[model samples]
Target: MNVSLILIILLVGAFATYLAGDKLASKVALLFSIASLGFSIVLLNQYNLGENINFINQWINQPNVSFALNADGLAIAMLLLTTALTPIIIYSSFRNEYKNAKSFYALILFMAFAMCGTFLAADGLLYYIFWELALIPIYFIALIWGNGDVEERKKAVVKFFIYTLAGSLFMLVAFIYLYQKAGSFLIQDLYNLNLTASEQLWIFLAFFLAYAIKIPIIPFHTWQANVYQKAPTVGTMLLSGIMLKMGLYSVIRWQLPIAPLAAKEYMYIFIGLGIAGVIYGSIVALRQRDLKKLLAYSSLAHVGLIAAGSYTLTIDGLRGAVLQMIAHGFVVVGLFFASEIIYRRYETRVIAEMGGIRSQAVKFASLFMILVLASVALPTTFNFVGEFTVLYSLSQINVWFAVLGGTTIILGAYYMLKMYQHVMLGETNTKPFADVTFNEATTLVIIVAVLFFFGMYPKPITDLITPSLENIITQINRIN
Candidate 1:
């Protein structure tokens, strides 16, 4: 229950950031985010000693739902990822001067709160509530503050809002079905339900609709590139870095376990869909002319591989998916932030419009190159471990699946290298390009350092996530 302290700090931080007003909002949010990270690390220490944190309060009676939260190995690992990213995200925003700074920063903290709740919630209704709560702030963050033409922004924002919301409705229906069957809204209770094959398939698809739009496998991904391009850089970072993982995490925590029979019955179909996204997204990314949109497609390819891994329903696959989730979260934020840094100086995002910036910004170019390499799953980068594991998992499923998914490595390198050459190498831009400022440098340094450190030594995180994933696989296999 004491892990409730983690959520408490984030929620209070949101309000405190708002009340602190424009002058101190970002600073206050940063402080609170750091505190949240510190507390989560402490909790992880406790978790190591065979301990967990769970909090419950009596709430709804008709549906038999309660406000409940628990931090197990899997939950805490995600919580750690959420809390860890919040401060880095806030710090990355320090150089920008946001209009209505209090509201902007407050929304960021609010998002952190909701996302943390989603990760920690132990009850089905509570998780769903937190899940929906996350969409509100991001909507405003994009709508009020997005870029491009106002009408275009509206179209993209509304499309994104409607798409995700519509997906959630199906999920709510599934949760209601589970509630009826189990007579309780606790996740474990739903997991134990003895639903027949047809019911499991229906429930599986319902959850899949919700999560697919969010993780956005293949065709469901139309909303992504536009939103990433239009939204302000911070919003883009949030969406790519942490929000997308919500769906992937749900697949592991809720969808697969609750409907294992259906999941198994359709495993190949879903896995094939995920691999398709990998190939389709990578192919599309190879053609994108805009920086943000290109990264958006790149993200799609990466997550597709991760999803394929999770669907494999094996220890290696699930472990790789979790590790890759964390890795992708970090690298994408760094990549998008690099784009933001360039936009700040050049006032453009078109790849053709940018060229040879390394002449002036050696430090920036080096860091950007590292991130680009990491994105392509370069050795000695954290991404390699995740990519290798996911591909290995897919190989176990079908060698061809791994071969198809592995195109990301080739295509990722093609686009990323082409990007780096056009944007940073060759003839220098005629205009003077300034080097990264202290704050920008600080952010990039932290990102690169973490990527390298974990790339070298991944055992800590792998160990942390394995036990929970093992138990999950056990639940999944029991259905067979």
Candidate 2:
């Protein structure tokens, strides 16, 4: 179960492929991603619940940090997600030609390594290093491969980089302060440090700003729509599918437990903001004309619910939030990929430019409809299961809050269905577009299969997450 070895193998494969030549670069990336996925599954099979696995070697003596990597149930779940998506993203991008295919595929592999590191790193400094490392490959991927007005694309990438980095600085300061107090950068060590309410308050605030901006809740979310809209579909998939989860994961693993009293005292304010973001994002999404922007706003709303669920401080709430995080990652990636398929055919992203696609592309329409229904939290879909659990948990806290948060369903349906009607089912106004190609069909079918499979049998995932959620809640209660 040495996960570091998995990462090393992926990087080596990627570099070797880079030297192999442009024609083989994508194939190499796909091979690496597939091998990584297999390794992740093996690691999952070997994991013991309620146990921490750490690999450590001293990295810096002065800072008293090590190259620490650890995983529990939660970390394993995230690792599964990162591995699962990388191959799909690589495969999805294969039809397009890149001038520097080797570098492009290499960067994608590098991003996977960074994401795995972010999930597994056990020391605060190690986590921060991986956290920052994840952004660099994405920055290049977007800046080099993105679409839209060239200047706008560049501006969007820069804005995303600066905003996330700025928030991360606050988190760095919080980590340094904790290290100064606790004399070590290990996460578990900091968790055991007893700090005053005031100290906890500031530390919590620092971490909250970092995670919030990364999650991009409400006002902090200004950079996301542009970034999503401008970045290449692969970059968008990684950002929405796996990268954003890093923020939510940090909140559960690092923020709440490290500052429980502060979290308890300030739970309402945090929950309130999440509630506000949910409603606001839904409303804004309803008005979006571009497919990517629409999906971006919708992602904000989904994350808001997850945030609110976290603040509920209830076992079911946290469990549902974790479930929702995984569910949303899959659903959103499918939605964006679906949109990319249409964009490839029509050469447009505007909803008005699309119509009557269902007439020519039944497979595309059917899959798109299923994904849209999933996005709207329809029953027999994983989204419904996740949202229902979160809402039920919220009901235990405050019925009014549950109702408010649940309005996302109505808004989500309104916007998603509107987009579907405009894009998939209307009078024919242009030449019939070609049906989905084999590669596109294969990608969408796999996404659809996973969506339905998880929707029908969510127990395995729920069971895997429940024990970890219970442990976290137990700690929160002990401190509060």
Candidate 3:
């Protein structure tokens, strides 16, 4: 079957599942998710080992928008990540009793559709539409089903929506300007269009705002903590695991090549923000008593380094950033799931509320420990591979820059260990927490397997990214 047909079927399956009653909704959703995963694997197999796939036809000839879908190594990698995680997420939520199970499953499936579209979209306008489309379902999921006070959840959802949409509007305007100049919305056409330095700077700024808000860098990151705190476990997993990567991916795909000179000239500004986010997020995380908030800040710090790496425009930097995006997604999602387990047992996310879990629940404690180590970039974990490459890239740019970026590892250990000690260690002050169920254990084991597998043998992913990175670097050098 054709890949596009599979995508349409998956979308339709989601709605069909929604129409099904609560008893069968989750099962149907899981079936569709598995099918999507299978289809994505087939798509990966169809690619000529190291080539991209593009499907294009005319949509609008005048302003030059096309119904275009393309997937390179990067897009395929992200697609696999999305499809692989959806089933896990759906399975993770199996124990819960949602108010409207059908709608919940529908939203999750709809989110999958939007995310796939975002990664596959080749036309500028088409990409934007998919980009914005991804945000709405998540907004409702968080608002309707999130934890915390009703007012607080609403506020958090609104803040996240407004911040992201505001930046995206600017990005839409930039795309329009680029269309005016290039007479086409095709990504390649935009790349080929020569524009003045001043024009590039303005367009870069516009695109920067959009991705920055999504990435939730310093000053623009106020919404993330609250959103992460309030969101349901699945919602939080989707946002941290998949949605944040969208911004990082955009920085590499749209920001750099579209305005290479501007990126070069303003590299320091981004580097500065990246470093600031690192320090600021770390310090804030150090003070966060809530597990979710701490993870959220740590995410900011991780992405800061990624943003800095992208600005370097070096092969190692870009490759490391992409790798780190994948690593962090897995690590953060695992950590968040760990938090959910604790919350289910203790009914509180406050770190200080519980202790002595290690003795009572050895498996849970062990899994949490492994995830924490990964979060802090331990050797033999995927995060380590990504961080090592990124720091090496930063060192090439400047030793001090690498040093500044390296501080995240230290700070990461400081907070993560502290949180672990507080939550998983000490005297048994609370009731004995139950051990992880088979399902939960299986989910965590899968994540750990991928984390270590990628960490040990990063060559496949590295090879997958190298060709595209080479192409991007060639363009950067020519434009420079």
Compare the candidates by lDDT and give the number of the best one: 1
Ranking by TM-score: 1, 3, 2
Candidate 1 on 216-316: residue-level lDDT in tens? 89779999999999999999999999999999999999999888998888889999999999999998998999999999999999999999999999899
Residue 82 displacement in candidate 3 (angstroms) = 1.2
List model 2 lDDT by residue over 203-238, tens digit each: 999998889989978778889999999999999999
Model 3's TM-score against the true structure:
0.98
- How does candidate 1 fare on TM-score? 0.99
TM match of model 2 to true structure: 0.97
Residue 135 deviation, candidate 2, in Å?
0.6
Whole-model lDDT per candidate: 0.92, 0.89, 0.89
**Prediction 3 global C-alpha lDDT:** 0.89
How close is every model to the real structure, measured as TM-score?
0.99, 0.97, 0.98
Tell me the spans in candidate 1 whose CA falls farther than 4 Å from its real position.
none
The digit string of per-residue lDDT tens for model 3 on 1-480 reads: 344655685698789889998889999999999889998888888774544456888998787789888778888788888888888898888877899999999999999888888888889999999999999989999999999999989998999999999999999999999998888899999889888889989999999999999987878888998999999999999999999889888888888889998988888889879888888889999999888999989988988988888888999999999999999989898999999998888888888888999989999999999999999999999999999999999899889989999999999999999999999899775576999999899989999999999999999889877888888888777743
Better of 1 and 2 by lDDT: 1
Quantify how close model 1 is to the true structure by its C-alpha RMSD in Å. Answer: 1.0
Best prediction by TM-score: 1
Better TM-score candidate (1, 2)? 1
Runs in model 3 with CA error above 4 Å? 1-3, 50-52
Winner by lDDT between candidate 3 and candidate 1: 1
